[model samples]
Target: MENMLVTRFGHAAVLVETEDARVLLDPGVFSVDEVFELERLDAIVVTHQHPDHLDRSRADALLARNRGALLLADPQTVEQLGAPWRAHRDGDRATFGSTTIAAVGELHAEIAPQLPRVSNVGVLVRSETGPTIFHPGDSYATVPADVDVLALPLSAPWAKVSETIAFAQQVAPAIAFPIHDRTISDAAYDIYWNHVANFGGVADLRRLGQTEATQV
Candidate 1:
């Protein structure tokens, strides 16, 4: 569907588009620098406050350019980022033109016992007559229902390959793509990609490179 365009900007940054709305998710530090250059945006969704998950400068640039764009995030992120945002916790839903976003998940995955756990809310975005996609931020929690596409985080401080595989197996979406993957080198990233591609996966594994969009 023309409205269901999903572009991966590396790491966890994703740009989701509909006929009437354009939503950017997690314009983090590791995300492509071009995210700051977006001309039009309907909303920006920050799953958490981590620098690698929420880059304030890019967000500022985007919001500054599109004054009416909404910034949606969890309470902690809205508080920590100190930006004008709407509090979107689990079960809360909002509409942006022709698209709808449903908040999901809660806390981020644990980095360590000594480290503090932060709030992270996954989002389910659905556009008019297009695919429904879920971006789960830094968590491995499964969505309650299967989706058309899933942004699967393949690497992070708080998860393992086995856990990633298990999460995919559980969610069992029609298509799953890698995200949260800037920490690894190209070769190392390939290893993870190969595993996800070749494993006895329930969902169709897809690797969306930087700035690449695929129809789900």
Candidate 2:
């Protein structure tokens, strides 16, 4: 078993690479540029149909480039995007070469009471040798199990500082880092970090910026 490489493309998109597989998760608007640079992928997983998580044109472009890559997403998203893709619910699991991806959770956190809630699936990717990595999409849904590397969200319309910190502590991953933070200002980021660092007791919280990677 070889180590898996986790690379962030800012916002919700991430590239999880193992010796034999390369998986791209949520290649949305914020990550389209980074996604465009990739030459090949084994799979592309989308959490939902939100523009921020699934940019239609860019995703199509990616699939066009790599004809063999598979597209995996929740049922709602699959309905919206349509065909040639796998629909994963809360408990579905799929394997591609050396990597296994499990879909967790079903609904996106509420942006507001009046706004329609969309489907969102937090992805848990594991391999034989590397640390398990969980990207919880846009929801602070329960972590199905302990992970080695948790991609925690720092800021979003549906999240707050306290809730995000609590989520991290609850998941209790061996190492936690931030994602879904493209909307905040520099000052807001400082505030989020302050609270998260102070209240995220016992969890090894690492501040990972856009396009950053943490050794697994």
Candidate 3:
């Protein structure tokens, strides 16, 4: 079994590569040109329908390039693609060979539901990677009690330092990685230590910046 290699492409975009194939999530900021190194993806898993999460035009272009590849996403994302795609709901699992990915429903933007917005979801990817990783897309809180590696969304529109810290304290993952952060801030760094850091306890809290990669 090979470790699941994740290459953060800034924003919510990430390229998760396994030995069998590569899968991308929420790649919106840069053009496909920037991801020249990411080649021949087997699937592209999307979390929601937000522009920042999915570039409609870029996704259509890439979908054409890898037309045969699986484009598994929420209903809105699949509807936007206007192509043959797999729409995943909560508890739905996609198994490719020995790999497995589970879709868990989530709240969108932590805002009022009456705002007439679409749905959101979190992804629990469990392969032969270092651990079962959870990328909570843009969600600031979740119900799952256990997490191995948490790719937490920080510095979002509605997320405060207090909410993020409280979330981490509740889940208490084995390791926590800061994500969805537009820019690194000292204040945000302080929030992690003052709140999420389990140095005195057990969890290994890690912060993966725009360019860093954790060796699995």
Judge candidate 2 at residue 205 and give its lDDT.
75
For residues 134-162, write the lDDT of model 1, one tens digit per residue. 99999986465847788989888898888
Q: Report, for every candidate in turn, its global Cα lDDT versus the true structure.
A: 0.83, 0.82, 0.68
Task: List the candidates' TM-scores in order.
Answer: 0.93, 0.93, 0.82
Residues 1-216, model 3: lDDT tens digits:
237676667767767666666777776653234443455878778888877777776666677667667778887767766657778788888877656678887557655655655767778777754456777777754557556667777667667767777777666677667677764476656655555554313267666656556643
Distance from true location, Cα of 154 in model 1, Å: 0.9
* lDDT accuracy of residue 212 in candidate 3: 59
- How many residue pairs clash (N, CA or C atoms closer than 3 angstroms) in each of the candidate models, in the order given? 0, 0, 0
RMSD of each: 1.6, 1.7, 3.2
Candidate 1: minimum summed lDDT over ten consecutive residues — where? 195-204
**Shift in Å, residue 66, candidate 1:** 1.5
Runs in model 2 deviating more than 4 A are none
